[model samples]
Target: MTESVQQLVRYTRIQEIVGDVIRLRASGVALGDIAEVENTDGEVSIARVIGLDRNIVSLQVFTGGKGLSTDATVRFLGRPLDVVYSPNILGRIFCGSGEPIDGGPLLTTDRHVPVGGPTVNPVMRVMPSRMIETRVPMIDLFNSLVESQKIPIFSVAGEPHNELLARIGFQADADVLVFGGMGLIFDDYHFFRKSFEEHGVFGRTIMFVNQASDPLVERLLIPDMALAVAERFAVEENKRVLVLLSDMTAYADAMKEIGVAQERIPAVRGYMGDLYTQLAQRYEKACDFKGAGSVTILTVTTMPGDDVTHPVPDNTGYITEGQFYLHGGVIDPFGSLSRLKQHVIGKETREDHSQVMNTMIRFYSEAVESERKQAMAFELSPFDKKLLKYSKLFRDRFMNIRVSLGVDEALDLCWKTLAECFEPKDLLMKQHLIDKYFPDIAEKETG
Candidate 1:
């Protein structure tokens, strides 16, 4: 990386200060350039040049511009935002500004990589084929996670999105985990850290958190820092890295707030016009390197008012390969999908895996119909009664998010649940599988 040039400009005349924005008359100020504002009390704060029109430049002060006057000075750092990248970054906790808040040793390396770097070239990206098993049947058996695939968990506010993310962090088949938490509450942060420690994966996980009490401007830095470190791990170290971001809605809110402060025209739902481009810039970072490790992104996008049309989720749906709809605390199989799962499901898993997945879903769908029939007090067929029983078993056995079953064990349990509910002929499976897995249910049945 080339060394960043420091412009070192000082402007004392402040024209306007409104909502963490400082406007002044300055020349040669480039957009995205870092700035330092020294108040009259000799205290300095960091900022970045967000807008420049004619001789007027506007900087978004990271300190929220609490107290300022014409006596304040601004220095334009020639480079955009940056963070240090090294192996030492693992197992460390940093604030949204990429500074260690855990009182740990400062980054000893002098190497600085700019944040929000460009996406990888399509030519450099290999087709993703490997599966990332989390041992959750809903994901492993149904929507298999593929390496380098960008996907999101569509959920609402009260859903256990964070807990689900932490669960994946604990169990995902990755060499490293990078978690970026934006606008998170203190209790949520504590929960994540404690859960990681209890699960014994905290040592391999790196956390960058922007708490609710932190400056909103800094919330913009979490994704960049998390992705920067994860990219370094995947490229330099050749480690399979999984990046998990919670509540991207909060990040979008931060962007909206900053845009409002900048006086930019709002787009749909008061979001910026560049929403898609900005979001793609980050999600596109998920890539599978040709002979190296991959970086897979699994983010949580909380839809406001549970509306999928909300601008944040609406724009996100276009960028991601598929989504895991997390409704009612369990991953709704009807709503969740893995577009890339086909690349690895049958090719990587057992032969019976695909057949079992289809059979179970088919039965589950029929079970839903049976439930409707029962609700309307219609006459129930023997098969419908069986489906009602199977429905309860399926939910308790598999759909329950709390059920912790490995992929292989979950597949075996599917056969167990089927044999207990219906005869082998009722399964509508291939005769070979029926004979192989489903023993004579009649003989096993108690009179």
Candidate 2:
């Protein structure tokens, strides 16, 4: 029998209920198939099959399984969870269950697409060689987020990672923006929606939010829904889509909670053994489609207690291309890296881009060393004083997250900062770059 025929199968006996997970004996059930569990009281709850064991199947209720009795009827939908994808969804907000929460008109169901589908085939992927400028000096001049690259912002609790993410959402040069907030508090959710609206990007953005008070199973749906819509926009509409998912640690924790309810064997830190696989499945959805547009993923992975060794961040470090380390309210130049930056830096940007980037970082390293010497009360050399000056200028000009500048503009500012702190000879950059792009302070005074 076909899947549609299988949809007619229904069972009235629920064998077990553990937390939000319910198990029943069914023969024609498939994993990821949606089902309706109707209570004897005439209320129905939606659920999806999560596991199978020959004749037994486990389903996770989208609504908590509270007050659900053993006699609840299970009628399989024979299809996976789907989200609406159309121009009507633009500027709209959805909850984890893919329902509209923005008080907008209900979208037609004819345009719905299944979530959690397979990643794009390698044959359909194109090389990512373009840069997605965010106008943030640190990322534009230093890390250079590349199109179709999957990277994360490694942050800790109480940091402004969401603010940075929101800044990128409004400032990034992309055709569409998809924002997913997993386990966010009401205040953070309000901030994101308000930021996009105030910056005038809300009209081109789609949001999938799962608040902290929502059902645990629904938190798992946010990324899948956002990515499903983003993929359609990139492939069908041929638009460059940027996806931002914040606090993936909460997503992982939701998985762990479900795993514990299902009594699965635990891996390191009580997380499921498939944690890496789950994360890779989502991150790999980022791709530059051949002969079409691209989908770039930038996520926020919070490391608990500032510990990188935590399972969520540790597993994430292996899956993503690179990370932007956010610490002490700034993107740490020393810890942040973009492995694909070589594809665009100096090629898509100004020729002086690479030289200025390397020189600024080198001088900043020395300046940090100079800071240590000053702290120890050691005698400071004349050059150390210059390094200190350069350090302060660099922090104010480029390191501050709020400082925004175009790539070329930031490069010019780099040369100015260097010239003010040291002579042209002091900079080890190529003479050609210095001669061509370097400022002529002496000639200016003479003129």
Structural similarity to truth (TM-score) of each candidate: 0.95, 0.97
Alpha-carbon RMSD, each predicted model = 2.3, 1.8
Top candidate on TM-score is 2
Across 273-310, the per-residue lDDT of candidate 1 in tens digits comes to: 99898899999999998777799999999998999999
For the record, the alpha-carbon RMSD of candidate 1 to the native fold, in angstroms, is 2.3
lDDT of 2 at 88: 85
Error of 1 at 272 (Å): 1.2
lDDT by residue (tens digit), candidate 2, 305-411: 99999999999999999899999999999889899999999899999899899999999999999999999999999999999999999999998889889898898
Q: Would you give me the overall lDDT of model 2?
A: 0.93
Q: What is the lDDT of residue 161 in candidate 2?
A: 98
